[model samples]
Target: MQVRALARGVRMSPQKARLVVDAIRGRAAVEALAFLDTSPKAASEVVAKILRSALANAANNFSLNTDGMVVVTATADKGPTLPRRFRPRARGQAGVIEKKTTHITVVVSNDIEPTRRGYKRKPA
Candidate 1:
């Protein structure tokens, strides 16, 4: 079974978060958490926070085993942008300062029973 959790309105750009999410895709949940812990990117912390939430959802809601779960899917989507601020420039000109946000979602799955291509096998 698969379980997912979403963290919306994260105060970071989607492009930045995507880089962090890529490292953890298709990896075990525990290992992913460890990588996030030592990663130096700015987005690593935010990705770690969301991954933890997803892990909690998998455990508490679906009764999945934490040790057996894998990160099936992780995505960082562009979210709503706040009003752009302006910085004063030469000759009374103003520069646009855009602040981007991201929405992150992670899905974890544990194969309680082995099946071919996620399909249920019928007895012969």
Candidate 2:
């Protein structure tokens, strides 16, 4: 069984958030929460919130026990960027200032095995 939670248009850039998500991947749900709690990065808090949401979903909606759940998939994908702004630089040059955003998703599951890359199927 699996449950997913998404945090869209998060203020942080995808590249930065990816670091935190990668760390928590394939970890038990409780362990992931602990690591996120102690992490200093701004992204950790957002990821942790989403993780908790997933846990609640598993418990309330599906009536599943989340004690042994694992983070099956945790990803941070680039979201739409806001309008670009310009900052005046030396020599009267305008420097482009981009405000990036990201869409984060986390899937927690139990009793499932992740598939391998380049997977091939055999006839039953």
Candidate 3:
């Protein structure tokens, strides 16, 4: 059985969070935690917390062995953007500023093997 955890309205952009998520997907749970612990990206901190929650859910709720679990899927989705703020520009013009939010999900499973499809790079 796959166990998952979600964190909503995270104060980060989905694009930035995906950088960290893509790295940890398909890795062992313990290994993923280790990478997140040392990652410099701000998103890693949030992802780590959600990963821990998923492990806890598996162990406590589903009675699964977390030591053997692997990160099946880790993803970040764009969330509702906050109200737009405007800053005065050079000639009385307003500059729009958008504060983006994201929703992060991490799924771990001991029974299922993690598979990642390789992306092909186009010739320049």
Candidate 4:
């Protein structure tokens, strides 16, 4: 089973969020949480919350074992930009500033297949 969590319009830029997400992909739930905890980036806190939410969704909604689940995929997308204008002291020169936002999605999965045994012909 798979569970997804999303955070929209986060203050961080998509580029920054993507760097944090790249570090935790394909990692176990506990390990990912730990990585996020020690990460120096501000976006890690937001991503951590989303990860925890995803884990809870997987456990509560899908009734999946949390230990077997992993962060299968994580993505950060650009959101709406806030534009602002500021004037400098040079002959009434104005500059445009853009405050970017990001949308992050995390998916956790617990659907590993069990390996088959070769010597299983004893008796029914």
lDDT per residue, candidate 1, 14-78, as tens digits? 99999999888877788889999999999999888888998898888877778877777889999
lDDT of 1 at 112: 33
What TM-score, over all chains together, does every model reach?
0.82, 0.85, 0.87, 0.83
Model 2 vs. true fold: TM: 0.85
lDDT of 3 at 101: 100
Model 2, 57-90: lDDT tens per residue?
A: 9999999998877888899999988868899999
True lDDT of residue 86, candidate 4: 64
The number of the candidate with the highest lDDT is 3
Number of the candidate with higher lDDT, 2 or 4: 2
Candidate 1 lDDT for residue 25: 81
Number of the predicted model whose TM-score against the real structure is largest: 3
* Model 3 regions lying over 4 Å from their true place: 114-124
What's the lDDT for candidate 1? Answer: 0.82
* Pairs with steric clashes in candidate 4: none
Ordered from best to worst lDDT, the candidate numbers read 3, 2, 4, 1
Model 3, 4-121: lDDT tens digits are: 9999999899999999999998888898899999999999999999999999999999888898788888999999999778998998899888899999999888865544442222
lDDT of 1 at 20: 93
Provide the lowest-lDDT 10-residue window in model 1: 113-122
Model 1 spans with C-alpha error above 4 angstroms: 88-93, 112-124
